[model samples]
Target: MSADKTILIAGTYDTKDDELSYLADCIRGQGGGVLTMDVSVLGDPKAPTDVSKHDVAQVGGSSIEAAIDSGDENVAMQIMAKGAAAMAAQLHSEGKIDGAIVLGGTMGTDLALDLCSALPLGVPKFVVSTVSFSAMLPPERLAADIQMILWAGGLYGLNSVCKSSLSQAAGAVLGAARAVEPPKRDRPLIGMTSFGKTILHYMVKLKPALEQRGYEVAVFHATGMGGRAFESLAEQGAFACVMDFATQEVGNHMMGSGISAGADRMTNAGLKGIPQMVAPACYDLVDLIGWQPLPDRLQGREAHAHNRLLTSVLLSTEERREVARLMADKLSTATGPTTFLLPNQGGNEWDRPGAPLHDAEGLAAFCSEMRAACPANVTLEDLDCHINDDAFSEQVLAIFDQWVAEGIVPEGVS
Candidate 1:
């Protein structure tokens, strides 16, 4: 394949030959190069392709016949994703690709997304699948510059809507390829997290403050995916330091709030030994979908809806202690200089005086437990102010500056 503007079209050429050919032609007609790879395990493809089913099986460490013979669709799909990712990684390493596209049903979409995930972010990745809307493959794993989820039926016999969707998707892919450019660095990379309630606060205050500090702030919404993305970037050494303000997701996971970041969220920076400043920014409550949607055990407990989108379930004394323990466990793993700032008055706006989820006793329990459990290497400080207080913000920034200074020249800057 030509390295310049080449698009890798990966899928089962036997089943998707017509659609694949149509896509390939469309890409070529747009003055772009195209390479097709067959990922089908069962049949020989009719189209002339750069990579065949045999090639994937060989790279994937399994035979196509063996996959087909297994009769297990899930296993087969996993093999395809693994093989396709391996192949794509190899091609990427060779610098022979600029973009990629794939078409399939549920299985095909899964396979393509896996391969796409293997590719670096910002690359053109597209998937035209029959089950795009119904299928729930993780979009985070895909490798394309843009993902266009088209609603269509089986790959065979296209309807008017399907044809229109495919055409639009093709245009999007080509447009992405032509328009894609490297990100410009004019701002410092500041890592920030927020939920729907505090989003306005972040957009107004913390973001502007960081930008004023001559840093480009990368904000991660405190959803599960946002936290994962931030952690992923940290693992890649992408941030100078992280200001993990909205750590409420930790509570989510702790309380089974549908939005947990799992165990890996806070561990990345600590393991990477990056300078970090953390806070119980919104620790007063674990987020749920709605007040009535809470678990039966949690029913009648103090709950408040921050907005229509988020319901906050107040943490009990027991839950607070558990969250504190988990926080301490995560903090103990830090390899670099770190600080945990506790806002004595409240963690979030919702936990302040006159707020619905406020619980001074529970908050105190959490802080005390964390202080007792935290390793000596990780500094713990309690501030007599709310999280949004300017004093708190200044303290965090000062501590961050000190950590950065220590990291830059460990012995003494003087």
Candidate 2:
């Protein structure tokens, strides 16, 4: 590990020269190197940068000439954003920079998002923005696994309030780059989805069983953003295989809930043909708007408040079948090997003969629809045990083991 780190300071130097310069000095005081990349769209930067706006805008596949001549701030920013991302990526590839930190209001954050995304995962990326925690921006727009800091009073210039936030961000990025080890993945990475342990506890046992067989298990929550990130990384071939057990987001989206990973959630892993095992875990619970009264359509449905922000509504027999159909249509197009598993007794922990969520009719509905829509390349498996049962995990592992032996599963670095 190197004692010193190189930090990329990416921001609009035309208007934020003082704040950016202060941040660079703070990083240097802590024994780190700085490479400032200017992303200004309107005027030339007040100070010199290692990489100018012209250098970055050209990289974005658009010319700064078009931006200045058009007199459209949007057009210029778009071009500069691309250029900044291109320049930063090139520097990182050449070992000129290790991590990045950016300070911006809104447009700055927008450009910063692309720059951070261009740098691969495991590199510490941080952004200081006024809207760091705003809910108006969908989590899907948060393109990278980038950390965000609330930029208090960092609007136009450097002040006491602004300096305090900028200084901390500078120190934080430097310390992280020096101390944080790259996220290591030496085993076959498995991407699994889950909700709560109570709803899907098989993961607790299944994780170790897979690790024991020399594979890494990476679990993604079934929340909207979690599903999106999983699919994005899947498209990038990040996982050797995936255990898509929790299908709650699928049900949530079909019902037009805000908790959707878009209509294209499960398509990536299928399109990429990564070996996958699919299950209807938590499919009985549809995410509904929370922190307020339920909609009129859900007037008589059984609902459970997952938290202050989100609630879960029990689906009817027909709705369960609809979800199954949606999933089948999506999974049927998979170019890679796939196994769709069904638990005849229950799909989740509390869904059984006498439990609160048990519905034999609902389970049957899904099974029937999936069977009818399953493609020739996909296999459907039915187990007599509950989803959380030891037998269920054993069956899933047995299939995975067979896939590995047959070279259906690959070893991946991500």
Candidate 3:
């Protein structure tokens, strides 16, 4: 490939010479630049390349000989991942790379995925690998960001089958680079969370209001993965502020509910130093698949059968206190502006008066405990309104606006 639209082709150059060369030719035919980097442990590279063993060792901090001598796959994998990331970062800084492509077997796939993850989201990055058809952990982690995996069947060298796959992979990266536009940020990006029950409320008022105010609101369903996706974007600097309403997932995390957002859901915004407006929007209960399928320990608890497929188990005073403490601790780390608004009347639709699981005492205890544990920088406000109420939404928006005006949000953040 000509050294002209920069593309970094990384792989075990000793093993996949034909496939790498074919891909390089395809890239050059499309008028793209190519820089081949040899990631092989052995000294002999079958193909001609710009970056060699010395360059890889200098960037990766470990020689291939050391990695091979150790005979530990995990350690070698880690070293390769670090090396690829460093090289990718250096290329990105030099503004020489328009995209990147990697061809490898299972180990190669893992290394490529790690390097892709290191690049900022939206960069065109692809991997042609033998393990792509399987549900691999690396691809799952790099979803929609920078990694695209093309499954090449069989473990052997790049035969006819592998060559075709590599060609298609090359085309994909070039296509993506030509078609994708750098993200435009004319409006502030607001992160919001919702569940099936609250989707109507959000669509009707909250989303529209934010959009009308020159903000791009991204609504994530509070499923197990949905919460994590939102947090990932926040960490990648995709959001200007957050409106975390469906915090019910935290209850799942605390009570072993099936819909837990792992432990990293609520802390991303805080760690990223983004201004956030939080609420116990649906933390009154933990969600389960169905009332009949409830665990034996949860059998006697009051439950709300929201649908045939979903049920919510009410939290006791003690459980509510625990949840509140968890929320407080998570929010306490906020380095930027933050406000935890409590809907005193109820937390969710089922927490209202006359609801079977409604318990004023439990809610009161949660509010008090959370307030006590919250950091001095985080302001706690108790609004005498339901979470879905227009007034409550407006109050939260006003607080966000105040923070923005005070320069709490970093300057130049849309």
Stretches > 4 Å off in candidate 2 = 1-3, 288-292, 411-414
Candidate 2 C-alpha lDDT tens digits along 23-130: 999998888999889888777777678988888877788777888997877777878888888888899999999899988888888888788877877788999999
Off by over 4 Å in 1: 1-4, 61-72, 130-150, 155-157, 185-188, 196-214, 290-292, 408-414
Task: Look at candidate 3 and give me any clashing residue pairs.
Answer: 188-414
lDDT of 3 by residue, 133-190 (tens): 4544421355335555655553666577766777788778887777768667767788
> Over the stretch 107-195, how does candidate 1's per-residue lDDT look in tens digits?
88888777877777677788788766442544235332337567465467656766677677777777787788854544446677766
For candidate 2, give the lDDT: 0.83
1 versus 2: better lDDT goes to: 2
Comparison by TM-score, 2 against 3, better one? 2
Of the two candidates 1 and 3, the one with more favorable lDDT, higher being better, is 3
Per-model TM-score versus the true fold = 0.84, 0.91, 0.77
Number of the candidate with higher TM-score, 1 or 3: 1
Counting clashing residue pairs in each candidate, in order, gives: 8, 2, 1
Give the worst 10-residue stretch by lDDT in candidate 2: 135-144
Clashing pairs in 2: 56-83, 273-336
TM-score ranking, high to low: 2, 1, 3
